[model samples]
Target: MTTATPQTATIGHLLRDTDLSRPAYEQLLADATLLKHQRASGTIVPRLLGLNIAVIFEKPSTRTRSAFEVALHDEGAGCTYMDSASSHLGSSESFEDTAKVLSRFYDGIAYRGFGQNSVNELANHASIPVWNALTNEWHPTQALADMLTMMETTTKPLQDVIVCFLGDGHDNVANSLMTSAAILGMDVRIAAPAPLQPDPAVVAAAQDIAAQSGARVTVTTDVDEAIARADFLYTDVWVSMGESEESWDHRVPLLTPYRVDAAMMSRTGNPKTQFLHCLPSIHDSTTALGKKIFNRYGLNGAEVSNEVFHSTASRVYDQAENRMHTIKAVMLSSLASMTQGDR
Candidate 1:
């Protein structure tokens, strides 16, 4: 991994996974792993010593929000968090104006929101690095954490690994997984009902990346076919945030068959196959949504089962933990070289 010098201080924002080349992706992973170990050993380095960053989230999050806040604090930086209710991004003032104003106060920005265009507009306005924490289109930061978890759990090289995503294949998590896996040279499979499969353009884009990286990218409706000997079984919420609750009426029946239950895991034909969910999962009737799902559909889970989510094969929690490490790497690589005078 080549280190960035002061001359190359302003690394571009991570608006999407394709923003990173193969070498850059690998470098970030290596940096993340080192940072994780350093954090564990109490030798964590603080790169953003005097920097101040802001996280503006238009969507609600548990992992991403906590990860960004903790990661910045660990790196000796000050951070301010603005939730959707607190920040009037488009309603009160334009996203462009908000971006320009915030850029002056913060060194970098992390935004999780509904439209890709919002993040794009913000990035266009700000001179500093802007990361897309989430959008309707992509979740690159989550994908980074997920891949780091995969590397920790598997012995095979990335090129030889197979990962299958089940349910809501069109969602942000699926898109990012396809994009990141292709860049990392992993065999990627998407299994969902026909209506919920990933966008053709997204598949085509991942395929183009795969062609250069020797990765295989496939989308299938047959759950058994997609999961065959898969090294990882991944999922996201069948319906995402900002989507109407009414969407569940249609999505539930269509996605139930693809749910990551023990049976679906067994279909993988790999007993060692680990389960991954970009959670807030409907694993049990613990949350209000989970309870409603069970009561309405007579289904205990939406995209994953309780048995699997809490099982030994689940690495979802580890995946969540890695988000901090990888995000720290992104910020450090992007802003660490800039000094007070440079700013």
Candidate 2:
């Protein structure tokens, strides 16, 4: 049997088919946009007051860590950052015990663990909101940031857009995209080879939701047809974190045809076609890993060419910054309701 909290959980779980209505999701985007504007204009920010949150990161991250920590801090909430290396929860004790203890200490918990099952196990035991900072199966927070970025750039409802996701199209990011595409009414296309396509179950679920939203979902190896109607081009790293360097030899050849360079953009045929990524992109050698790969594997760019990733069309930075705003919405809304119920 699948582990789950009681029916009346605090925040709706962000799993593939969890019941987060589009109106609710859009409201979060709107709230985040407004908060961003307010913060930009120099105003006193909203505070979470009594809420306490904890972040447990198994994989090190620069953007995700900074965005979440700063988001809670800016909202006047107490945040305790945890280390997987030294933490008692998993390192010393069991996951179930750690989750139960954390549920009592914090209003919300965000964790990035080795496997998807670990995060799900925590949610099953913890009564409070459990956010997936990242997982092997999904990165829901990044999905929120992506949709928000698309809205910020296009000024169009997600339902009206054709968002094309190309390149290594079946990783954690791709899964999150498919999940959110179901939640919203966006036309979704994932172009990847047979071995790299999205999970069949996710595709079936998205097809079901698309039928309801009047959205179209298509999976194909034919890059030409996939990008024909595209407004936004999205991609992620060819190899995800925690993956060994040896995997590059296997991934590069499999993913090279899917790279987003000027030619692929040209194939889109949409002059206004925007680009989005979840950052830490291997489009350049800015990072040590990228440089090391360049030196050892003779690869300057992996899944996306630096020319496109750094071009005027790349919306990655905007996408990166939106993580803070959207995450705040998820935290505040859930915490507010908890406070009301307590009173």
Candidate 2 similarity to native, TM-score: 0.92
Per-residue lDDT for 54-113 in model 2, tens only?
898888987888888988887887889887776876678887998899888988888887
Total backbone collisions for each predicted model: 0, 0
Candidate 2, residue 145: the lDDT equals 92
lDDT of 1 by residue, 188-208 (tens): 999989999999999999999
Per-prediction TM-score to the true structure, in the order listed = 0.96, 0.92
